[model samples]
Target: MKPESALVLEELRSKLRPASVAQVGGFRPGADPLTSWFLKGVCLPGEGLPVWKGQPMFPLIQIRTDELPVIPEQLKGIALLVLFHNREHHPFDQPHGEGWLIREYATLEGLELLPELETPYHPFPVRWVSVNDDAPGWEDAWDIIDLSEVNDDTQASDSFFDDFNRYGGTKVGGYPMEIQHSVGIKDFVFQVGSEEKVNWMWADNGIGYFHRSAEGIWQFSCQFY
Candidate 1:
């Protein structure tokens, strides 16, 4: 969408292969020094280029030019800020002074990874969030509960119930709150309130609530007490 972002996306789209995905931390086209930097300076498996473990990444998946529904009509392209950090000390341990380069593009090809990573990770799914054009009325129907009211000791709730349907991006009625379901593209649950004590062990004390739009977008509502 922006002039600088337009240039960056065009450059990447030209160098990418069809149906591939690569990871990068940051991208700057006309920086005086380096053009781009990795997340925590972690590079690809063997390449010497600097990269990071949980850098804000864009998985460029190839598709027919006519099939991408989310590509904005005005912006040249759109880059979603997908953060992949599962490590215990992740979001906090990231390198300092690094921010995601959100951009807009006109087409689907204006994004990519280096040739090496693309060959193996290409043909992957391209999932990004765009505005829901056909959102339902339920968009305004949801609630947020405090975990303090739901005691882990007795696994009891004052008023909140374990209704996974409250959070949806599709048909509704399914929320995976355990690590076991983390293997897929499903929404995982976590305990709300007091981030210091939040852990998988407190499954019974879960209090976060979310809802999904029919257009496959998730909306979350959480209240920590």
Candidate 2:
């Protein structure tokens, strides 16, 4: 990892306390062993830190240690830009419209860190964009900017699809363009207004999704890889 990336990870570990553990490889419960181990090895439990949905939640963290030879030096700086966001549906308390959190971490530096890695492991690049009431229009929130627009074109073949596939999960066999992705972590709502308030939502990619529904309510959700 790059110096800045490592510093940020270390800082995040120190600042955010792990509420719940998640497993990465096998079928163990609680938290992923690798992720749990990484968190335990880095940051210890603390008080007063923000918890995921009033419970403990651990966001996936990817660190490129020297042991991983496949990681390219060019991709070291990419990890620093990892972003996470919350998804909420209308009517707040409906089961059919599940409200959860989704995180998307991209190496916006234009480097494919681990090419050989498979699903849930591929390292894609992403950037952070926020759409708010201040934005020119609400529709601008739906625009997910492609990183290739600013990076080199050499690594551009099927990158977005590969990214969406990796994060969203393998495409279901017969579905036209519908993809299914897992909700790795739940989101905590930080209200920004009163009974009628503006809540800003951000995604792991650093982009914010916002919309104005009927009755002046501002709704937001993050779209991830």
Candidate 3:
């Protein structure tokens, strides 16, 4: 690789942010999810949670923001974020918050643990671990500065992006590793990949993406092979 390209690659690498990854240890009442994704937590009652087969819906994920590593500045005061998927809705094709839901809490006072609820699949317990591995895929270039330097040399370009594929799994911050391609969601947040060990599958081994819209609303979508 040319020295100019190598220097540009180093500069580009400096822009990469680390995302906390899910190591997913065996069951525990509550394990630290690298302080990024807390799957279990107490919260105010989900008073209007949609019903399914006579049972209220189970939240797919519960994230505590008190310890989040990377997040938008506006969410600095938020206490928790929760996600719910309605079995009645399409995994990725429905309107935001209609089929899927993302709720953020401002405080934790008077909260309680989520009660046992029915789920379509076995909800295996998992926890998060911070990982230094995070890099934007070519698809995520729009979220970063111009890629002109990356395109400066084929070899340098190839070397930098080559790391993204090795990180195809659940992560916080950074970019969502593409199952098909990025949906171009703005203000992206975290993602959860289908875990075979936990039987968490999105369609045929897809990944779930959680992000925020321009209006500051959180949304959910899934992509699969």
Candidate 4:
């Protein structure tokens, strides 16, 4: 939280939920997840590879939700979350396997990791970590408390939340790092940024956000610079 306009920021702050943050990186141990399998396909639902249009989808990140330090209510029964996207685009309105895929698991019971995919981004485990100072984007703020409600403090408050530099990072909790506009998409839980260590990068350095819906289903979107 920045000290620039702490006085008027409380309204925005109260609308946001704070949870334990986690970093999804560290390629050691050779068993970490989030490895890039761009061209290669993933075995989801135990049937066949997930495809979009005519191309196959690849796994972007794999999280053992049960491994997190603090599992939020939204992720209660989820044991694993494997995110997937087409080689080029991510059409949000499309169905499950059209442009992107979010594979959820209730348990790791019969799970298996494929052999060699020859992907550039190596497998880095998603682990719990401390969250840095951050707040939702201005649009997200406006939707929560409304700009009109803030009265004369509009400009200061907008600048505070819209500053992407202050809030951008790859972490599990807190607020999302918006590259463009804030998504009114509720239940802001985790954020993913291009990790350089394992050669992880989305678009020209995009940031992805995750939100748990009221139905326990996760909604996501990625924005790039």
RMSD of each: 18.4, 19.2, 3.7, 4.7
TM-score of each: 0.24, 0.20, 0.78, 0.72
lDDT of each: 0.25, 0.23, 0.63, 0.59
Off by over 4 Å in 2: 1-41, 44-50, 59-62, 72-225
Alpha-carbon deviation at 183 in model 2, angstroms: 16
| Candidate 1 local Cα displacement, residue 176, angstroms | 12
| Greater-lDDT candidate between 3 and 4 | 3
Tens digits of lDDT, candidate 1, 1-225: 344434433332333211111112133222211112212111233433223455333222222222334332211232222222222221221222222111222433323433323211212222222222221111121122223323332323211233111222211122312222221122321112112211211123333333323443433433222
Ranking by lDDT: 3, 4, 1, 2
lDDT of 3 by residue, 1-225 (tens): 888767766766777666656665465544533233223434576655545545455576666665555554536677776676666545576666566667677877666666665555555454555656566666665456566766877887888767443355666676677767665536667887777655566778878887776677776777888
Please give the distance, in angstroms, between residue 83's alpha carbon in candidate 3 and its true position after superposition.
0.5
Best by TM-score: 3
Model 3's lDDT to the true fold? Answer: 0.63
Clashing residue pairs for model 4: none
Report the error of model 4 at residue 136, Å: 1.5
Give the TM-score (vs. native) of candidate 1: 0.24
Query: Which is better, 2 or 3, measured by TM-score?
Result: 3
